[model samples]
Target: MAFTICYAGFRSGFFTIDHIHTVKQLIEKCHEYNRPLAVTFIDYEKVFDSIEHWAVFHALYHYDLDSLVENFNDLQRTLQQLYDACMWVGLKMNMSKTKVMANIYNVTNPSATVGSEMLEIVDLKTRLYNQCVLPTMTWTLTQEAVYRMRVAQRTMERVMLGIKLIDRVTNDQIRSRTKVKDVGNRITKLNWS
Candidate 1:
């Protein structure tokens, strides 16, 4: 099920809040029952906004399903079917961006593939923090902290480039040679995003 903001009509309902509440309730139920829950969040890279509205509805209607698979093989098959369906509708899935997350209790190392590339597996909480929380927190860094980060990054870059402090290379020269963005600028871009 999907809950989206109603942009064209009356905006009385808090759909985003309701969606979060529903997810929270599902998590609580899973915890209470001591059952493992695996969730896959698919990023479409603005596929809906780029496509015709009716095409979006047609794609959804063609691939709608609500069921749980019994094993990783079944999951792989299901993902293959999904990939085929998306390709049939002229949508491409970026396999590199796809990730599979499972709880610690899950013994099998979950393996899934779309076409020939294997999807990466990541720890759920770590991925959530890295993707959701860390970017926001980066904006709050003090000047000193940012300076330290830049110093560390420059040191690493210098090491990779076989340069040393005694080499008499200027910071601007090193940066021009390395072609990497400054830590502060990267953080600013992250905050804006």
Candidate 2:
């Protein structure tokens, strides 16, 4: 349920340097506070086509959330309504044809699915060190940077896989299985190495 803030004033792109700087500062502050942090991008430009239109209206009516929250009761009521709406929508969600959150109770699909997939892949890679790939002596500053680079490369590949999968799905083509298998191969290669 990510929203893309697009100001028509800026023609170059959706986000600017200020946005990055603000996010960087926020992440830095989270680290300083010893809070677990995660950054993810979600695209909802074409979400309407995939969603049940009536369900969105149903959610809006049931939740009746305030644009501004005043109290706990309001929050509870709003949450209940929202949950009901999501449940109605999810029941109709095509599992075989539609991709939802892979391993969560939340709405991880709707385009943020890529972020979850990448996070899962990163978690998998991180486990390698726990399995004795990186000893204390070798897990110094330089090795940590190299490990980060590898993670970044794998993340990029996973992102590419998401793009390819989405394209295939949208185009109504016959390459879905092949695309998934290709991503699986890449994941296997990463794990084996």
lDDT of 2 by residue, 67-145 (tens): 3233334433443454455556652322223221121111222122221232121222233333433232132234455
TM-score, candidate 1, is 0.51
Each prediction's TM-score against the native?
Answer: 0.51, 0.25
Error of 1 at 45 (Å): 4.1
Residue 4 lDDT in model 2? 33
Q: After superposition, which runs of candidate 2 have C-alpha atoms over 4 Å from their true positions?
A: 1-15, 45-193
- TM-score top scorer: 1
Indicate the worst ten consecutive residues by lDDT in candidate 1: 1-10
Q: Write the per-residue lDDT of candidate 1 for residues 76-163, one digit (tens) a residue.
A: 7777777776667777776767776655344445677778978776655444534554454455677788877778767855754457
Per-candidate alpha-carbon RMSD to the true structure: 12.7, 16.1
As for candidate 2, its clashing pairs are none
Task: Provide the clashing-pair count of each candidate structure.
Answer: 0, 0
